[model samples]
Target: ATQGVEENIQEVVGHITEGVCRPLKVRIEQVIVAEPGAVLLYKISNLLKFYHHTISGIFGNSATTLLTTIEEMHLLSKKKYFFNSLSLHASKLMDKVELPPPDLGPSSALNQTLMLLREVLASHDSSVVPLDARQADFVQVLSCVLDPLLQMCTVSASNLGTADMATFMVNSLYMMKTTLALFEFTDRRLEMLQFQIEAHLDTLINEQASYVLTRTGLSYIYNTVQQHKPEQGPLANLPNLDSVALKAAMVQFDRYLSAPDNLLMPQLNFLLSATVK
Candidate 1:
């Protein structure tokens, strides 16, 4: 492979580049322009479907074939500028992601992604030893597949209107749980990438919460609570966290507090408690 792949196989590479990589690039571009939520999810669904079909064509449900291809791709990455370009394209897309929280649920897109991930991981157990070539393949596949998902979360978080944010966050949270649940099924070497996503999701939740709070204005809420004490409106009624924005913010704030993260600074916690009660 160092000398480059066989010229015959290089022709097959051209086929794959034409059929899969080109379509994937178009889908990634779709994601950039698509409206947030269901439309965005639809673009993601198409991208994963294209990827699943491409990989399945090459591997054909055979664990051995899957592993071999991974090794081949990794090696080809070094020798083939086409492979190099593909990897670079994937990495650039990943770099654009920031992170999110949402039930957006086993959405069609989410389901497809998990299905592909599970199929790959299920192809072999982490405990099984592979030759150096196979190990390289595993690394290549893991990086190529999961790296973009973390970024997907970022895109989802960034694009949503607050109205959809909390529910979406909840779904995203469960998606994280599903991702971690599959870790035991993959090679231990892949654990680091898996863990990075877990950590990134935690940060996503925090960022989502922060945005919600900022939108609702914690200082304003706190002052409002102070000036319009429930006691002042006793008997007839009580001052309430009645603003829809405040309620929405509370939902996200409570979510961050509950999800695993160090996002909530103590001062904000103090301000939140004072504002609510």
Candidate 2:
């Protein structure tokens, strides 16, 4: 009879403890999912840590049920913090992103994206990531925020004319590169931006060269040579390469060489990079 009485008491104690912890677990989860910002998550995690330590001290630190609940809540909050912050920025980028203006200057999308980065970087002081993990976290934050913006810019530029598209990309990428330069631990990102800029510059240079060749009347000869095979024996056979056409082309070429600056494409004036112009 005594054994039956003891078992009943233990069952009652177990139900009471579970009842207490169940409400707490629900409340912690609500706080974790509902909280809008990472800063708040850090504060909540710190508070949980304090409570965890206090409980462990009293309960001999043997992973008591309450302590275990607190630890799980702490981890959940952290995971939610990063996920929430990234999702918020990604949604904003999709909504407000825009294309570059006519002058090849930074677009509305680039401005807003840079402002978002500034705000995120400002919050780094309050970050709760451990010292060893901070670098990795920083990289993730940049990739989550910046990579999408880059892709959006690329997509937007696709609708532009060939002459303006590469220039706009260069301008947008240049601003992004400069903004990142003001921050630390972004060497890899800088290198990637630099590489992209160089590639665009190469395209722009090729376009300009083609324009010059066509304007100076040399593209006819250039294309003929490119299309002609060695076996074709191209010297005097082609009517387009006659003496009169050659003289006119040479005159146009000489005129371009004498006043090259005056003959530049007007669109080049809108290019943002002075070094490129």
Which candidate number maximizes TM-score? Answer: 2
**Per-model TM-score versus the true fold:** 0.34, 0.69
Model 2 C-alpha lDDT per residue in residues 1-277, reported as the tens digit of each score: 9999867765665455556687998987887778656556656665676677676665443336767788788777755674476657666766755766878777786787687676565555354445445566568778887888888788778888776888888888888887888776789999999999889888888888888889989898888978888888864588778888888989998998998886676567777777767
* Cα misplacement distance, residue 24 of candidate 1 (Å): 32
Q: What does the lDDT read for residue 126 in candidate 2?
A: 53
Can you tell me which runs of candidate 2 are displaced by over 4 Å? 1-78, 95-97, 123-131
lDDT of 2 at 112: 71
- Model 2 has an lDDT value of 0.74
Error of 1 at 205 (Å): 9.5
Ten residues in sequence with the least summed lDDT for candidate 1: 268-277
